[model samples]
Target: MKKTYDVIIIGSGGAGMIAAITARKQGKKVLLLEKLPTLGAKLKATGGGKCNLTNTLSSEDFMKSFGKNGRFMSTAINMLNKDDLREFFLSIGVQTDTKDGFRIFPVTHNSSTIIKALEAELNRLEVEILCDTKVERLLFDGESITGVQTQNEKFNSSNVIVATGGLGFPMLGANGDGYEFAKELGHKVTDLYPAMLPIYVKETWVANCTADTIAKAIIRVDLKKAKKLKAVGDLIFTSKGLRGPVILDFSREITPLLEQYEQVPLLINMVKGKNEDEVLQHIKKQTALNPDANVVEIVSTLLPTSVSKELCLIVGAILDKKFKDQSGQVRNDLVKIIVNTPFTVTESIGFKKAMITRGGVTLKEIDPNTMQSKLIKGLYFCGEVMDLDGPCGGYNLQWSFSSGNLAGHLL
Candidate 1:
C-alpha cells in the first residue's frame, strides 16, 4: 500500500509551510517536505533575525511595491490580503507591531517566536513534516502531477504544490529544485536572474562611504533606453561593491546592464539640500568662506569625509591649484562634482548572493487567480518559483504567504 495525501507540498520555507498548514486547516491531509535538517531556515535569516512579517498598508500599496510583476500578484493578494495575514498571525500567538515605516515585525521582535508559533500550529494539526529529504523530481501521469520522487522514497498525491524557493541563500536550502519540478510538468520557465542583489561599484571611496558613514544615499540612474529610476534609502559598502537597504531595493535593473555593458555608469545624488544650480552657489559660498579651505574641506562639509575625498581625486584635475588660490570657474566645477558622481559598474553578485531570483515558472501557464496550472491538472506553483520578484522590506514574504494561502485554500 502506498501512502497518499490530499496535498503534497514540496519545500518547507515560508510559502511551503503556509500552504501545508492551510490545506490541513481545510480538513485535507497534508505532507510538507524540507531538504534541510530543520524548517524555516530562510525565514530565520529574514529581517536580520527579527522577521519583517508583513506590511500594514493597503493591499494596493503593498502590491505596487513588487516591481513589474506587481499587477499579476494582485489577484492572490486580494484573496488572502494583509489584514487576513495579521489576523492569522495573531491567532497563532505571534503578536506583532510595526516601526516607523509601517514595516510589521513580530511583537516579540524575534523570528524564532514566529517560527515556534507556526511550528506549534502545524504540530497541533498533525501535518506530516519530513526533513533532510531532497525531492529530486516531480512524478506525473500524462498531464496531471500525481506525486513526487525523492532520493530514497516516493509519495503519491492528487495535488502537489511547488513552493521551493529560488536560487537565493542556498545554504539555507533555497536551491532551485522547484524549477526542475515545474519543467518536468512541461511548464516553460523564464530565464532566471538575481533581483534585490548588491551592486559592485568601481570606485573604492564610494564603496567605503556607502558602507560606513553615508550608508544611506539616494541614487539617480539613467539606463540605456529606459526611463530614469531613482532610489532613496540606505546602501552598504560591500567588499565587492555596495549592498544595503537602498541599493538592494533597486538592484534588479542594474546588474543586467552591468553584465551587458561591463561598465554601467551610475549617478549618485549626494547633496540632498539643493538643485544643481543652487549646489554651485553653495560651492561658491564655501570657496569665499575660506579661501584657505582646501577642496577636500569644502567637499567634506557637504558629503561624508571619506567619500568627499574620493570625489576630489576624480575631479582633482579641474582644481589643480590650492583651494585658497583656485579661480571662480574651479568653484563652479566643484559644484558640478556633487550634482553628478558617476561610477562604472563591473559585475553584480551571483545567485548565492541574491535575495530573490527575478524569474521562474512563466506566469502565463498558471492562473494567477487560483495559482493553479492552466496547462496541467492537480499541479500548482507559488512563491519565488513564479516569474515574480519583489524588493526588500517584507514584500517577498508577503508574496509567498499570499500565494501559499490561495493555493492551499483553493479547490
Candidate 2:
C-alpha cells in the first residue's frame, strides 16, 4: 500500500524544509523529499556559509527591492517578515544577530547552525523526511494534484508544494528540476540566466588592479538603453575581470543584455562618486602640497598605486612627471579615467559560479496570496523556483521562507 500525506513537499532546500515544518505544525502528515543525500546544501553556502537569513527592511521597502514583480511577494512577506522569521528561529533555540544592523544571520555565523536547528524542529514535529529520493514527476489528474512519483515509489497527496529551487550551484544539487516540473504541468518557465556572478571583461589591464578592492565604487551600464542600471558597493578587480558586491548585484541586468549584445560596456566610478571636477581639484590640491609628486603619486591619493598607474597608462600620462607638466588633453583624459574607468564585459562566469538563478516559473500562473498554482488546484510553488529574484543581502532567502510559509497554509 502507498503511504499518504496531507502535504508533500519536493526538495529539502530552505523553502521545502520550511513548507514541511509549516504543514506539520498544522498537524498535517507532511513528507519532504530531497534528491541530495543531505539537506540544505546550497543554503549552507549562502552568504559564503554565514547564512544571511533575512534583513530588517520594512515590507514595503523590501518588496521594492525585488523590482516590479516584487509586489507579488507582499502577502508572503506580510505573513512572515524578518521579525516573524527571527521569532521562529528563537522558538527553535537558534539565536540570530545582525552585526551590520540590516542583514540577519545565526549568532554562530555558521549555516550549519540554522540547518541543524531546522532539522531538529522538523524531527520534533514528526515530519517525514526522505533524503536521496528523486521525484520523477508530479502526478496531476488534469485539474488537480493527485500525488508525486519518485524513482522507486509513489506518494499520495492532494496538496503538493514544488519547492525545488532553480539551477544556480550545480555542485550543490541545483538541476532546474522545479522548472521542469512546472513546464510539465503547463506552467510557463521564463528564460533562465545565471546571475550574481563575476564577469570577464575585454580589458586585460584589470588584471593589474586585482590586488586592490575599491570601496563604495559605483558601476553603471554605459549603453543608452541601460543608462539607468547601476549598483554601488565594494568592487574587486579579478584576473578575469570584476566581482564583489557591486558586480554581483548588477550582473542580473548585464546577463540578460549579454544574450542580445556581444559586449556590454560599463562605466565604473572607482573614486567613490567623485566627478571629473572633484578629482581634478583633489589632484590640484595634492600637486600644490607636494610639487615633486608624480602623476602616479597624485592619483594614488584617490586610488591604489596599481590602479593609479594603470589609469595613468590608459591616458598616456607620463608616470614620473608632475601632474601640471602633463599635456592639457592628457590631464583632462586622466581625470575622466579617474572618475569613470571603462570596461567592456565580454562574458560572465556562468551558472557554475553564479550565486542564484534569475528566471524560473513565471508568476502569472501562481497565486502570490497563497502560492497556489492558478492553473491546477492543490498545486503550489515557492522559493527561487519562481520567476522573481532579488539582489544580495538576504532578499532571496527571505523570499523563500515567506513564500514557503504562505504555501504551507494551503489557503
Candidate 1: worst-modelled 10 consecutive residues by lDDT: 316-325
- Model 1 global lDDT (CA atoms, 0 to 1): 0.80
**Tens digit of lDDT per residue, candidate 2, span 1-411?**
999999999988789899999998888999999999998999999999999999989999999999999999989999999999999999999999999999999999999999999999999999999999999999988999999999999999999999988888899999998998999999999999999999999999989888899999999999999999989999999997999988999899999999889899999999989998889899989999988999899999999999999999999999999999999999999999889899999999899978889999999999999999999999999999999999989999999999999999989
Q: How high is the lDDT of residue 186 in model 1?
A: 85
Off by over 4 Å in 2: none
TM-score of 1: 0.92
Model 2 TM-score relative to the real fold: 0.98
Report the C-alpha displacement of residue 112, candidate 2, in angstroms: 0.5
Would you estimate the TM-scores of all the predictions?
A: 0.92, 0.98
Q: Which residue pairs collide, candidate 1?
A: 211-237, 216-234, 291-324
- Residues 1-411, candidate 1, lDDT per residue (tens digit)? 678988999887778889988999999999998888988888887778888877777888777787666888877898778778888998998777886667888888888987888888899999999998888887888878788888898899988999999988877887787898888778899888787877777776654464464434667665756457778777566655777777787787776666676677777666763568887677668878867777777777788777766776666533345554556665556667677777666777777778788889999899988889998788998898999887788888888989998899856
